[model samples]
Target: MLLLGLAACGGPPAAIIGVDGVSTRAVDVPGTHLLPIYVATSRAASDNPHLLFSGERSDDVSYARLVVSVPPDRPVGEVTRASTLPPDPRRHFVVVAAQVFGSEADFVSSLNRDLMERPAPRRHVLLFVHGFNTDFPSAVTRTAQFAYDSGYPGIPLLFSWPSRGRTIDYVYDMNSALQSRDSLLATADALKESKAVAVDILAHSMGNLLVVESMRQMALLGRFATADRIGSIMLAAPDIDIDLFRKQLAPLPVGDPPIFVMTSANDRALALSRSIAGGVSRAGNTDPEKLAELGVNAVDVTRVTQGDRLQHSTFAQAPEVVQLIGRYLGNDGNLAEDNDDNPIEGVRNVLFEVTLLPARIVGGGRVVVVNE
Candidate 1:
C-alpha cells in the first residue's frame, strides 16, 4: 500500500512551551497547523527534554511525543471538539509536540531531553489501538482528537499497524495486526520497563482483540512486568469470535488492575461483522457462564447511542460511553453507577442490551451470574 507520509526532514528541533508550573519541549512534525496543542507533561523543565515516549505520527513518517497538562482551573471537555486548542489560561488539560527522527537512533537520541524536561509525575499515557479501515495518519489524528475530546491529561501514544484503510483488506489487516503483535509487545515492554510514566490502553474494533491478545501474551509468559502498567483497557466494538475468545482467553493471568470490556447489541456494524464472519463476535455475544471465568467485566452498550452508524464504534460515539471510559480509567470504578436504573447480570451481567431479542442477553433482564 502507498503510505501518505512527510518528506524527509533533518535533525529534530526543540522549542519551549509553558503550561501550569512546568516548561515542556515542543517537537516538530509534518503538519503544524493541523493540531493546536502538541504536548503537555509533568516532567520538570530542569530535566532533560530530548528523551520522550515516541510514536510514528500519522503514517507521515514524522514521529512525536504527546503530552497534555490540563490547566488546574479549566474544564477539559471544552477543548475537546474545539478547532483551536491551547487557549490562554484555560488550564492545560494537554500540552503536545512532536519531532522528526528518521531512524530509531534519532528517536532515542532525543528521548531524554523530552522526558526529563517536563513536569514530573506525569498524568497518564494512553496508547490507542484503532480498529479496522484506518490509516496511520487517521489513527494519530484520532488519538489527538480523542485525547482532546475526552479531556485526557496525558501523553497519547498511537500503536499503529499497517492497515489498508479499506474493508477488502480486512483479512490482510487482521493478519498484519496479529503478525505485529510481537512488535507491539516489544514497544510496550520498553515502556513497561522504563521510568517514563503511567500507561493505559484504549483499543477499538479489531484493535481490541490485538490489545487483549498482546497483554494476555505478555501476562502469560511472565515477560514484561510492565503489562501491569495497563491501568485500564477500553475495548470498543471488538470483532472477535465469542467462542474462540473464551476457549483462548479464559482464566487470564493475574495483573494489576481489572480489564473492562464494553459491548452493545445495537451495534449495527457488529451485525455486518457477524454477517461477514458468520459467528457470534465477542462485542455483544459471549457465554454467560464465562464472564468471571474470563476475568472480564462486560458492559452492555445497547442502551447507549454513539455515532452516525449507531454502529459497533459505540465507545467513541456516545457521550455516556466516553464518560464511562473516563470513569473506568480514572479509577472512579463504581458498580452502583455502572447502571443506576439499569439492572445487569454480574456487575457480571450476561445481558448485552441489544435492540432486538436473540434469546441471550438480548432478552434483557438481569444477566445470570455464574461461578462468581
Candidate 2:
C-alpha cells in the first residue's frame, strides 16, 4: 500500500503547550509531531517508521525504543481515521520519526528515563494492545489518540504484534495473536519492573483474546502477583468465542483485578466475528445476563457511537466512554466499587451490575438500574 506519511523530520523542538495538563505538542498542518513509544513486538522491525514491519512473526519477542512523529493536522482531542497510513493528502498524520533499541534492557532503560521526567502519578502507564489488521503506525497513532483524548496522566505504551494488516488474513492474525502471547507477558513484567505505580491493560477486538489468554497463562504458571499487578483489564469489542472466554476466565486467581467488558449489540464487527466462529456468539456480543453470570462488569454501549460503521471501537472515540475511563477508572480502581444506584458519571444504566454473578452477585438482583 502507498503510505500517506509526511516527509521525515528531525528531532523534537522545545516548545509545547499544556492542554488540560496534557502536554500538547502542536505543529503547523504540514509539519510533524514527535511522540515517544516503548514498542514490544513479535514482528520484525523496519528501518522506516512508515513501513513498520516486514510482515512476518518471530517466535522470540523483540523490543524497540521508538520516537514516532505523526502529523498533528487534526488537532488535539480528535482522531482522523484513514483506511491506510498517511490517510490522504488532506489527512497525513503519519509516523515521521523512529529510533530502535538493541536489547530489552536498553529499551527499558530509555522508557524509565522518559517516565522519570513526567510528573507524579503520571509514572503509571496505560498499555494498549491493538486488534486484528492493525499495522505499527496505526497502532502508534491510536495509542496517542487515546492518551490525548482521555487526558491520561501517564506514559502510554503499545504492544504491536505482527498482524498481516489486511481484512482477508483473519486466520493468520489469530495465529499471530497466539504467537505474541509471551511477548505481551514480558511487556507486563517489564512495566512492573520499571517502577510504574499501576499498569492498566486495555485490549480491543481480537487483541482481547491475546490479553486474556496471556493472563491465563500467567495464572496457570502461578505468576499471580504479575497478573495482579495489572490494575485493570478492559476489553473492548472482544472477538473471542463465548465458550473459550469461559475457559480463559476459569483459571484467573481469586481476587485478581476486576475485568471490564464493554459490549454493544450495535457492534457490527463482533456480529461478523460471531458468524465467522461457526455461528457461536462472541463474548463481546453476549447477553448481559451471561456477562453478569461470569462476574465481570459489563457496559452496554449500543447507544453510543462515533458514527463509524463497525461501532467496534466506540470506546476510544465516544466522549461518554472516554469520560468513563478518565473520570472514573483513572488512577484508583474506584469504578469496581460503584453500585447501580450510585454509578459513575458517563456510565449510565450499570447495564449488568452483578457482583460476580454466577460467580457472585452483590445485591442479589437479576437486573440493576444505574441510570434511568
Candidate 3:
C-alpha cells in the first residue's frame, strides 16, 4: 500500500531515513540539536525506502533509530524529509541519522546503548502509541516532536501498529490495532524488564484502547514490575468507549500507577468516533466525576484551547499543555501535593484544569485556569 503523507500540511513532518533498510545520511541544524527516537513497530516491512513499512500486520516487531533535527526557533511543526543536510528553514525536521536493527536482541542492545549515552537521571523512557490514521514515518516524526517539545530527559520510544493512514479505513485500522495486542504487550514488557529507570506511557485516540487492554492482560497474568518502574499512563483524547474502558480498568490490579486522562470536550475527531459508536460517550470526553469514580486522574483541557482543531493535539501543540506534561512527567508520578496557589488545582475529582489566556497580555502564554 502506498502511504500518503501521514498528516497534511499543518500536521507532523513526513520523512524517510534509510535506503534499502540502511541509513545513509546525517544532517546538521544550526543552533539546535538532533533528537533521537528508538522505534518498535508491528507493521509489515516494505521495500520502499521513503516509506519503511506497509499497512499490514507483522508477527515480529521492526526496530529502527531515527534522528530528527530541531529548528533553532521552533522545535515542533510540519517537517518534511530533506535529501540533503541543513534542511530548508521552513521544514520542521531534517533526517540527521537512522539505523535499522536486525533482531530483537540487537534492538535491545541498541536501546541499552542509547540509555547509557544519555545524561544522568535520564532513566525515564516515554512510550508513545499513535492514534488512528497514521503511517510509519508519520508516527516516527510525531513521536520525535513530542519528545523534543516535552523536554523529556529520557529515551522516547514508539509502539506503532499498522495504521492504514486514511480516515476512510477506520475499521481496518481498529482491527489492526486490536490484533497487535500481543505485540504491544511484548514491547511494554521489554521496557519494564530493561534497565531503564522508569517507563511512562502516553497513548492518543484509539491507541488508548490498545494500551488499556494490553495493561489489563499483563496485570491479570501477574506480570507487573514492582518498585514503581512503570510510571504514569497518560491517555490523551482517548477514543475508547466509556463502558468498555471501565471494564478494562476493572481487571487492573489495585494501586496500579496513576492514570491521567487528558481530554477536551471539543475534540472533533472523538466526536465523530462517539457517533460511530452509537453516541456512547467516550472515556476521554467523559466528566471528571465519572473518571474519579474509576480512580483515575482527570485533566480537563476544555478551556485550555480557544476554538480550533488544534484542540485535538492541545496536549502537544499547546506550549502550556506541554509544560504541564513535562512537569508532570518530570515529577515521576508525584501528583502535586501542594495544590494551594496552583493554577492547575481543582475540586476533588479534577486533577488539573487547563485553560488559555487572551491573545493580548501574554502573546504566547496561554493560561491554564484551575477549576477551584
Candidate 4:
C-alpha cells in the first residue's frame, strides 16, 4: 500500500525516449557534450526501437552502445529527459547515436579501440549498476550524467539487469536482480579481458545485492585471479540486509580492491525497504560503525540534504557529494590524501579530513572526513 501510494505520487517519468531520439546531427549542436556508454544487459530485446530492451529477463546477455548528448545548460548533478516523444537535442538529454553489437567479442573490441584513444593512466573503466525501478533508457542517461558530472575520462560501462521499472514490482525486481548474477559475473570477466587498466564499480540500491553475490560467486570459484585489476568499488544506498551483507563480504578477500559504502540514516526509500524486509536493517541506512566492522569504508551522508525528498540518491545527485566521488575516482578510490590540482579541492579540503576513527561522517553538508 505504501509503495502504491508513492507510485501514485509520481516518480521518474516512464516515457520511452526510444532510439528515435538518436540523432547524429545532435552531436554538432552548440554546447552539447557527447558521452559514449557501452551496455551489457540481461533484459530481453524489445521490438520497439524506442525501448531497445524490455523488463523481461532474457536467457542470453546482449550488448549495445549508446552515445548520449548532455545539454550545455543541464545542471552538473541532474539528468533532464525529454517530456515528449521527439526530444529536443539542444534542451534535452537525448541519444545521439545507437548500435547493437554483433557479439561479446565485437563489443570488447570496440571498447578496446576506445581505450586505445586514451593515455595509459586514463585507460580505465567505470562500470555502473542501477537499482530498483530502472529501465534501460534511464540507466543509460543516468550513466551519462554521472560520467559527465564526475568528469570521468575513462570508459563508462553499464551492466543493466531486467528491472520491471514499476514501484509496485519490488519483489519482481529483487528476483530479477538475483537471476542476473551469472550475467553480471560474465560482464566482469569481459571487463577483465578488456584493455582497461582497472575497472571501478558503482552499484546502487538493490544492485549492490547482485554485485556482492557475484563477487561471492567469484570467490567460491577461485576467480579472484585478476583481483588486482579490479579497482575501487562504491556501493551507494545499498538495499541488502545488513547481516546478509556481512555474510557476503566474508567470503571475498579483504581490501583487494577497496570498497566504500555510502549510507544515509534519513533515506526514506531505504526505510521503506526495511519495512518490506520485515524490519531488518538495510546496509545503506545502518549505522556506519556496523558497516565498518566488516572491513569496508562506511561513509555516512545523513547530513546531506540535497537530493530528492526520498534522499535515496544523495551520493550522485548532490553536487558536493558528486564532486567528492569524482575526486575519489580520480585518486584511484583513496580519499586519504589531498589533491591540490583537483578542481573541487576546496570542497574536498573542507569536507574530508582523514582520521583514525572507524567510520567517516558528513555533517551539515560541510564536513566529510573519512577514516582510513
lDDT of each: 0.49, 0.64, 0.69, 0.79
> Could you give candidate 2's per-residue lDDT for residues 124-231 as a string of tens digits?
677889998776656766786666555556667888888866677788999999988888888777776686777877888999999999988988898856444566
User: What is the C-alpha lDDT profile of model 3 across 1-372, one tens digit per residue?
Assistant: 122222343443343544211232224334655777888889998777656778889998888877766555652322344445334533445555677898777778878888888654666789999988888877876787667766666788999999978777889999989888999877876675567988888898888888888888877887754564887678888889999988998876544676777767777777767887899999877775576667676777776653235356777766556656765665665434322322222111213444333212122111222221
My TM-score estimates for the predictions, one after another, are: 0.62, 0.78, 0.82, 0.89
Q: Taking the tens digit of each residue's C-alpha lDDT, what string does model 1 give over 1-372?
A: 122111111211222222222233222222121233222211112232432322211222223454443333222122222123322223323334445345444543444344555464444566788887764334544565456445454455677666655666778777866766776775664455444456767888888777777766865786635445556666666777777666545445432355556666666666767777876566544433344346566665555554535456566644444545654554423322343332221111112232322212321112322110
Q: What's the residue-level lDDT of 321 in candidate 4? A: 72
Candidate 2, clashing residue pairs?
A: 4-86, 295-356, 356-360, 357-360
lDDT of 2: 0.64
lDDT of 2 at 348: 26
**Residue 114 of candidate 3: its Cα lDDT?**
82
Tens digits of per-residue lDDT for model 4, 137-252 = 88888888887877665889999999978788889999999999999988887877799998888899999999999989888988864454887788999999998998998887
Pick by lDDT: 2 or 3, better one: 3
Report clash pairs, candidate 3: 13-79, 355-368, 357-367
Ranking by TM-score: 4, 3, 2, 1
**Deviation from native of the Cα of residue 109 in model 2, angstroms:** 0.7
- Candidate 1, position 251, lDDT: 40
